[model samples]
Target: MSTSSIKFYDRFSKLYPIVDVFLRPQKRRLFEEINLLDHGKLLEIGVGNGTHLGLYKKHALIGIDTSKSMLSKAIDYATQEMQLLHMSGEQLEFEDHCFDYIVLSHVIAVVEHPEKMLEECCRVLKKDGSLILLNHFTPNNFLGYIDRAFQLFSPIFHFKSAFYLKDLKALKKIELKEQIHFSRLRYFKLLIYKKP
Candidate 1:
């Protein structure tokens, strides 16, 4: 991540709680997908402000993000049972098959290398564990053209790498047991990928 990007999120951390209200419907679905996991250690990447941490029930939970400012806001909500790591998703610090569930909400789009991140997610997941993702991507229509146009002129404003859309199409090849798209067509997508 660039210094500027880090700064953007640092500033964003302060306003995340208020900003999250607009994302409630999507967040609710994300929580619902997370609830499918029975029990065990859970790892949430890009866990900004740990806003949804309270919704998860787990014996051990670890939240990781590159932004210290974001993690700081989450400190109060995180108990001794939950751990927070200031780290990036591309280079996860965990060992193979370490976590029972991994949540990648709104992360794929912003990552510099989405494939490497997914590879790491797979590496750290226990056998049969799940990877939950929520993201916004180009629609498969005229809206997609608008999305591309926006990407051309407002690349920095969008900040998402082009591969985000490609990854959505490549989910099957990655060995996901299930991939479901939820939400209205153009704006958001929710996916559940269970490792085999």
Candidate 2:
């Protein structure tokens, strides 16, 4: 993450707990999907505040984020079994096939290079291991156009990390055994990919 992005989240850390309260409904649904995974080591990219860490009861978890402030907040919740690393999604500091499961929750749209991030995810995942993603993407309807227009103004709001809808297409380069879509709102997508 850039210094500006780090600073932005650092300032917002005070408000994040409050923001997370309102986000529970969507987060719950995402957590429900993740619960389907069997127990194993899991890597969560962009693990902000570690709010979702409690959801993984059976899995040993490792989380990475680019913001030191966010990692500081996450450490408060970290158990002796969990490890948190300060790192960027685009460059993962791990060996190949190191994790049985990889998670990207709302991280792709915020990264400078989504494809590179996905490549790293694939590289770190074991053969036939799953990659789960819960993210907001462009709707297939008119709402997508509205999102596109709003994205143009994101910079003014200091949301420089937001990406437009088409970026999801970059997933095509990765080999996936299955792809699943959930959620009533077309704007939100849940993807399940398997390394081949």
lDDT of each: 0.76, 0.77
Lowest lDDT block of 10, candidate 1: 161-170
TM-score of each: 0.87, 0.87
Candidate 2 residue pairs in backbone clash: none
lDDT of 1 by residue, 1-196 (tens): 6667778788878878886887777888777767766878889899888877787765478999988999998888888889999999889988999988888888777766677788888889888877877787776766677667677654464366333455544355445554556545646777677777
Best by lDDT: 2
Off by over 4 Å in 2: 156-166, 175-183
Quote the positional error of residue 97 for candidate 2 in Å: 1.3
TM-score of candidate 2 relative to the true fold: 0.87
Give the Cα error of residue 124 in candidate 2, in Å.
0.9
For model 1 the TM-score comes to 0.87
